[model samples]
Target: METSAQGITPPAAVYEIAGRRFEVGARGFADAVAEAHAAHQRPRCMCLVVGVEMYVARLGGGYIVKRMPGTGSHHAPDCPSYEPPAEFSGLGQVLGSAIIEDPAAGETTLKLDFPLTKMPGRSTIPPTGSEGDSVSSTGTRLSLRGLLHYLWDQAELTRWHPGFAGKRTWATVRRHLLHAAEHKIARGEALLARLYVPEPFSIEERDAINSRRLAQWQSAVPSPGKPQQLMLLICEVKEIVPARYGCKAIVKHIPDQAFAIDERLYRRLGRRFEAELALWGASDDVHMVMIATFGVCSAGLPAIHELSLMPVTAQWLPIKNSFEHQLVGQLVADRRSFIKGIRYHLQGGRGLATAVLTDSGDAVMPMFIGLAEEGKLPKAEAVANAVGMGAAAAWIWRPGVGPMPPFPPMQRARSLIRCA
Candidate 1:
């Protein structure tokens, strides 16, 4: 929530911050964010953070610029970013640690602990050992699962309450993800440019959507004998029913369209993400999210090149078990603002907390779900240290150990951060 009162850089034409008018070029926006200047800074209408702050967002036309949302700063109780109490959630374990931001570069570096792309053509067997130990890091790159988690969190899709139940839909998820991706630049390209979240295919809009798809996929086509470029798709899986020659992934949005996964690729998915597939089969409450790199064939059919799977709650929140469901159910009822910690590489609650609550200041709350049978606490000291949250407070809940912790009091209305 820190912001500076200064001029901005490129990727922006003109902007107003705290009633001050300033103008810059295309690279101005990025330079301002990177240098911690004042490009996208706007006065806070909510939250306790002092001064105007910068945020990644899109503006008029197609320009990616910084925006300040009155409800997104996490400072005020009524803001969408506001939470119960930092001590009640595990937000402290990540903020300045695992998740990072670079405004100038328009990128957010996420430290993930799961593998995204396996060695080309390598065996797809699940690596032996506990799931908690599977930390994937060759650099700052995030695994497919990690990327999806980050996106979900960034989209604010993880913040849910019972009141939002049934109100959330694929259209809503797509809208938020697209907005979150607005000013984000990943690997030298706009994140939104590389993403594909299919729109609801309708008989009326079929021709228009198809024409757009044709234009997009045509760029991926290569010269004779040249390899085609890969495209990224984030879609909810409907069914893995059999097709003419292999398996077809029926997408929830594009019900009329299917992505082909050849026999080999299908086997790879089953072998590598057996747990995800199994979880998807176990309940209708959880759904599978797939992030796959695909290429269009000469016949215009899309085929998978590399892919990964993840299970998310019906609310699109990432969840792994009934235990999390119970915890989330209560949190939702209490209207808490918390982010679920994903076990990408780590398994069995071996690292990080169950969830983290975010607040205005630096302190974040890390919550853990302790097991009574095991009679043990989660090994989260190293996790806290890893995320630079060693000094942050924490909360642990042991089932059959009485009721959960009470929600924190709301911020006084008098403390509102009035925006000019």
Candidate 2:
């Protein structure tokens, strides 16, 4: 029945996040702005639901009433809204105290770790020689690849438990993520506007869905007085078929449209991400995701300047192989909060933790999974020596290790998990 200073609707009720009590929602969540748009000028209510401040986000069907996660304000550990510590994921490295949040305004300001602009006909990945003061500026930024991981992590697409079996899908992911991003403001623009996720392509919905996609790229279109700009586009990969000159990617949504890549970029993509391609091709469930920057040419073709690819599990969490998927299965069976690791800039075959598991009772665990005969045990040891910090303890598994080592029973006091 009321609007905040920004004119956004309010949540249905306030649940005290920390106290586990109903603080606000007895009447209703959202309502049509009464005829008296300016007639009611009540001071803002701080948007606090329960004890933890909550914001009204418009996503999915109409609106979702959710709270800010990991502020120790979420209702319980098992709640889908609960978040693991950033240090448990690569988030701590990229965020490095660079994000500022305003609960009252329902907005977040994030410091990025990469550049967004590129001149026409040239790549701006920054040559190694020009990487001046790289170490000093590293904390304030994220690599293009790292940014993709951060978004997936923040969207909770990485979370899984036994109860979610067969429930995840691309459409649900698109909705939850678009909603997760509703309040994120980046570089003075709505982050939702800058990030594009192609809607599922279908003959029946093609006209309606494609028409709404323009708003995502309105800034990239040429205006009479203003020049065109390039923005990011993320989509599922259909195939990277070989084209006449290089390779052409058949993106999932825009079947009628294809993005062409030059010989150089294509070779780089194939070489660096060969493992990803193998995994995608070997299974019907694996999904390949690509992120790139592009602009429309005079002829209306989308020309890509830079691109990268990653493989995610059926559930959309990033993974490298079946072994990592096995580890994800174990964690989910136990209802633990964990982070999936991505090899952004790391060397191939280097031993990095397959994933990090956060147990409510025990300390944070960095886990390694492999066949002992595959030489992964040593690799895990090497990774520990390489990135020697943050993990409370190391957990290792291999082929002959019949079942996984036991985990502490799920903590019941602060849990909200409806199923195991």
Candidate 3:
């Protein structure tokens, strides 16, 4: 059972994880995971490699790949194959040879050098009127833009295969792709099949939900067979406040500060939560949320200040702690195919647009942006106040609503270099 901040308890429920079952009381599992993940220090085996053309797929709702047995490509039939839907043509083809290295893991790392297009690069899609909104990109490099959408919608591990808690690591799955590609490219390597991630989320619906629209974008529109001229920016959010039960107004009042509860005991605590949970994947969700939020911003900053109480009726599978559940969301605009500033946010660091809301009514902001980094808000009451009218802004916590002050609203007045 879930409990409201005011003491109204929902109902008790039992959930199974890795064959062991546990009971959840009103508080749920948010705090426990927060504490465990906070203390977790095993170095991760995954790393990011740009510029590789590897095959990826959502088979039977899970991510699966075929790779060479010993990472060699010379052995024929020895070279195994993993096939995705014919429609899943471009996963990630552009970028150039970039190594996804976990230097600590030695050869477990992969170098992805996806081929760029020989076709002339095209600028922004020509204005095709309202119909233009439906046009997809055409080229060889999978749209990093679309790939972001694919990666975010993946919920196979948590929602379906409960035991495989750590299966979603993008780097692990990328290695599987590298293996598959190696086998397909050469003869010595045999294509061996392995499940990348078990179960795919309802991407079409989740996307619609994230976008906050009734129309299904990925399903309704056929993927443009060619890749367009596009660039990708990898971002990492440093902190995230697990969603806690509280009044909308009260929850809004919570501050974004993440100081260690015991600084003296935990001398190594980083300045942010993502820094703290770098291995557990809190940052990826933050990035995806930001993408949806930018979609909301493009739609003119609708009434997004309402608190979200996602219903938790099942055995609450805890993503953060015994008290928290992983909540994924997105925003979209009813009109237009593109948004502004997200590319900037993806580039990272030092910009007034720390947060971006999408045209579809979603909003994205780093889980934490120190008050010192924020630009000064207008002192005038009408502009300075964080909420209601002209005070348009997106802070993890609304200023003055709870105990903390809101960060400055994003502004597009200046151009700046990214910090990534």
List the RMSD of every prediction in angstroms: 8.6, 9.4, 25.9
For residues 254-324, write the lDDT of model 2, one tens digit per residue: 88878876666676666666767888888887789888777666556666666667778777878867677
- Candidate 1's TM-score reads 0.68
lDDT per residue, candidate 3, 132-167, as tens digits? 011223322223233332232122111212222345
lDDT of each: 0.56, 0.56, 0.23
Ranking by TM-score: 2, 1, 3
354-384, model 1: which lDDT tens digit per residue? 7765431344456777766552454455335
Q: What 10-residue stretch in candidate 3 is worst by lDDT?
A: 304-313
Q: Which runs of model 3 end up more than 4 angstroms from their true locations? A: 1-146, 149-197, 200-345, 352-368, 374-403, 406-420
Best by TM-score: 2
In Å, residue 125's CA in model 1 sits off its true spot by: 9.4
Candidate 2, superposed: residue stretches over 4 Å from native? 1-14, 17-20, 23-76, 96-98, 124-137, 214-218, 222-227, 330-395, 398-411, 414-420
Clashes of each: 31, 11, 78
Overall local distance difference test of candidate 1: 0.56
Clashes of 2: 11
CA shift of 15, model 2, Å: 1.9
